[model samples]
Target: MIINKILNVDDYYYDVFMSISESLTGFSVNELQSTGLADIYYKHILGQIEAATFIEFLNTSKTILENSYSQDQLNNAINAEIIADPGMQDMANNIITMWYLGTWEGAYVNDLSYKEGLVWNIMHAHPPGAKQPGFKSWGVKPVNSNS
Candidate 1:
């Protein structure tokens, strides 16, 4: 159930991978792509999962991406199908795990994954050892923090 794959993978499914990730993670394609980790995550998924299984998953979700109107629409569409099957929903969660924590099944993919984890993006903070702030960065209010 645990495996790995990632990018530099410019084949048929790579685009779908990114698109689905955007829908699932609530991050724009540009934001996800800018991390330079898309290829790595894509490759990781391919390695961990059977080719046919992974391909079928992507194909099943591709229409959701094409017809997406907003977050709710995409979420509803994905949930209506994936959540109907617990196994499919698990795979969807695993994909989210790969993006948010940069690991699949609690295993670290690479150092870059840590630095570029979507959790930091969501928090509007740099990852642990990334984007080092200059002196006194902490003295000021957090950029995205309400406090």
Candidate 2:
């Protein structure tokens, strides 16, 4: 609750993150939210992303979205090299990585938990060391997808 009060992160931030997530991962907001990815991403951003850069990214992204940019345009804007500062770029990259990997790779890597990682969700495979696939699972195709 303290973080919620201190961050004052509203639905707008989550909406912006969802839009960016959809653009980056080609996944629907509903799908991401259903897996609790949205909350995970938001918390990661709050804890790791620089506040000023995050706010700027959100504002710029919201403007681009409101302008009715095509998916390609959205992607281009989100991935644009407009962020000149290294710190901002790191923040941006961290957000993108979190969506794909489902874990934040920050200064303190140990803070990330394999159980909650997103890589397994994307790979449709369990975390390598933490959870083993059931017996003989390796012999057959992965249940989620071939890839």
Candidate 3:
């Protein structure tokens, strides 16, 4: 439960990850000997930080970036666009989300802003220094996907 409390701030995302990890690896607070949910939460957070760093590195090279319907949809869109697949539009949105709410830097610096959790609102938040992406879809999915 200690891990749960620590992750409380981000329960919407991390809880699901915990459930799945527990199911797959059979790791729990008792088994891991974490002090509390915070320990568990932070451990996962560290992993996510590493993954996000890798993602930021990959995204920095893009000429354009788009927004995400939700944070989870981000990776799929990016992969789709990289291959020049039809999903490029969605990927563009994900890049835009990272640029604004996330992190991205490369050959050319582009800043972006989006209202939290919406594709179109992100464009509206665009700071003066950032380039605006032109994705048509503006629908926002709820932050938590689990019931």
Candidate 4:
């Protein structure tokens, strides 16, 4: 996408997003992309975020990724005080939250379908209204007995 153009990184836009997602959430690039979080994040950036701010965030992230040699290094870079601009920081936070929660900030909860949300992944629980635990599964000594 245009994110690649904005970041001017060697990797594709989705790959760049995957790297950021892995650094932010400790999840693999494949996991984030496969779960549709990457696409969601791209859409959010294009549709909701301010153009100049998003470009600034992408450029900052690109620089950080270019300097880091490993995943830990990337994580360190992200945690560093690289983004001093408040607007860029806010955009960065929104991207990080999208990776973790699978929803953009300010989205109404009711507007999201159960499976589309990533809270179930974080909570290690099935999505409500779909694949619910077996009968009495919650009452077992270990709530996760089915697993």
C-alpha lDDT score of every prediction, in listed order? 0.80, 0.63, 0.35, 0.63
lDDT of each residue in 104-134, candidate 3, tens digit only: 2222121212222122332344333344434
lDDT of predicted model 2: 0.63
Best by lDDT: 1
List RMSD in Å for every model shown. 4.1, 4.2, 19.9, 4.5
CA lDDT, candidate 1, residue 76: 87
Q: To one decimal, what is the Cα RMSD in angstroms of model 1 from the true structure? A: 4.1
How many pairs of residues collide in model 1? 13
What tens digits encode model 1's per-residue C-alpha lDDT throughout 24-122? 888888999988898878888777877778777887788777787887888888988776778778888998988888889899789888888889877
Give the Å error, residue 26, model 4. Answer: 1.3
lDDT string for model 2 (1-147, tens) is 434542654657678867766665667778677755566567667777556667776676677677655767665655563345565467666766666565567432233344445567767777777677788977897676647
Q: How many backbone clashes does candidate 4 have?
A: 0
The per-residue C-alpha lDDT of model 2 at residue 29 equals 76
The 10-residue segment of model 4 with minimum total lDDT is 108-117
Tens digits of lDDT, candidate 4, 107-127? 622334236455667677777
The Cα RMSD of model 2 versus the native structure comes to: 4.2
Model 1's TM-score against the true structure: 0.83
- What value does the lDDT take at residue 77 in candidate 1? 88
Cα-based TM-score, every candidate: 0.83, 0.68, 0.21, 0.70
Q: Which residue pairs overlap in candidate 4's backbone? A: none
What's the distance in Å from true for residue 87, model 3? 20
TM-score of candidate 2 versus the correct structure, residues matched by position: 0.68
What local lDDT does model 1 show for residue 93? 94
